[model samples]
Target: MNVGIVAAGPVHDIPDLKKVNHIDYWIGVDEGANVLYESGIQADLLTGDFDSIEPNRLESIKQNTKAINQFSSIKDETDLELAFLEAIKLKPTTVYIYGATGGRLDHAWVNVQLLTMFAEKHLDAWMVNSQNEMTVKYPGKYELNKDLSYPYISFLPLSEVVNGLTLQGFRYTLEDQDINQGSSLTISNEWSEKKGTYFFNSGILLVIKSRD
Candidate 1:
């Protein structure tokens, strides 16, 4: 299955939802249901406390959605996280998250952490917004496609250090280099060749790519 999750971030900057191809399922998190509706995209499932939406809008969403998973305002996981858990249960081949950025810093950070959760479960999850695409990487080899339109790539260590790191086809090459936490060593590396590869032996990394 191919699933798409919509969070509570600003939707005005996202591309036309109708232009997307082969979307088998759509999930709405909190006010995201309203955003989806405004974009003329129907959601398969709605999951949230309805706190962010007005009473009438919430009722309309509940009535229109195929399924609804309501939670109390006081909950451990964020609405987006809950949506992700539900999406994973369906065993989707790939999951795309919209409206994940351009929100509260805490919420954005938590959503970024969700990528790590997906990585742990061996799921392909990514945060896609108007300007950025984000994913979490564990120790392993990664093959990256070079998008000439958006060639800038950045890697931020999630742990104290990412050990034994190697980079190929990048402007800044590293072989068995250690990247410490809070370090800028891996920032803004461009693809010199058609593709790029990176391998790390330990720790987690947040990989972000964006256009100028």
Candidate 2:
């Protein structure tokens, strides 16, 4: 199953939720459940402490949602992570997270870590916001198509170093190169053909596809 999750960040930071491609399941984290209701989208699971939500609004959400998992406000995990645990339990092939960025820097950073967590599980996970789409990849070759929507691609090593990096069909090319942390060496690359290929021998890569 493919799952879509909406969090409690600024709704304005995301695209139209109604127009998304087929989503098999929907998850709302705390105020995100209310956001889904406001957008007239149904949620399969609603999770969080409900501390940030108004009492009446929380009641309304509890009434309409099919399932709910409320946690203590001072739990070990964040609301978003709790929601992710349930989503992962369902074993979705892919999970698309929205409203998880463009707010608190710390929260956004945690969400990126969540992306990496899913990637390490060998599941397809992506974070989408107004300006960018982000994901983490373990060492492997990937084929990508040119998209005018997100014309720029950047790769940042999540680990200390990435080894034997190679790229084809891009404005910049690399072969058997190693990139360490704190390097802007792979930022803002453009596709040179209809499709391009990328591969690496070791370490995790954070692939960001973005546009102005």
* Candidate No. with top lDDT: 2
Question: What clash count goes with each model?
Answer: 0, 0
Q: Score each candidate by Cα lDDT.
A: 0.85, 0.88
For model 1, state the Cα shift of residue 40 in Å: 0.9
What RMSD does model 1 have? 1.6
TM values, all candidates: 0.93, 0.94
Residue by residue across 5-63, what tens digits does model 1's lDDT show? Answer: 88888876565677788679999889889888777777899998979898987887777
Q: Per-residue lDDT tens digits of candidate 2, residues 66-98?
A: 898888898888999888888888899889998
Clashing pairs in 1: none
Model 1 misplaced regions, further than 4 Å: none
Task: Score candidate 1 by TM-score against the native.
Answer: 0.93
lDDT measured at residue 92 in model 1 versus the true structure, 0 to 100 = 89
lDDT of 2 at 49: 87
| Stretches > 4 Å off in candidate 2 | none
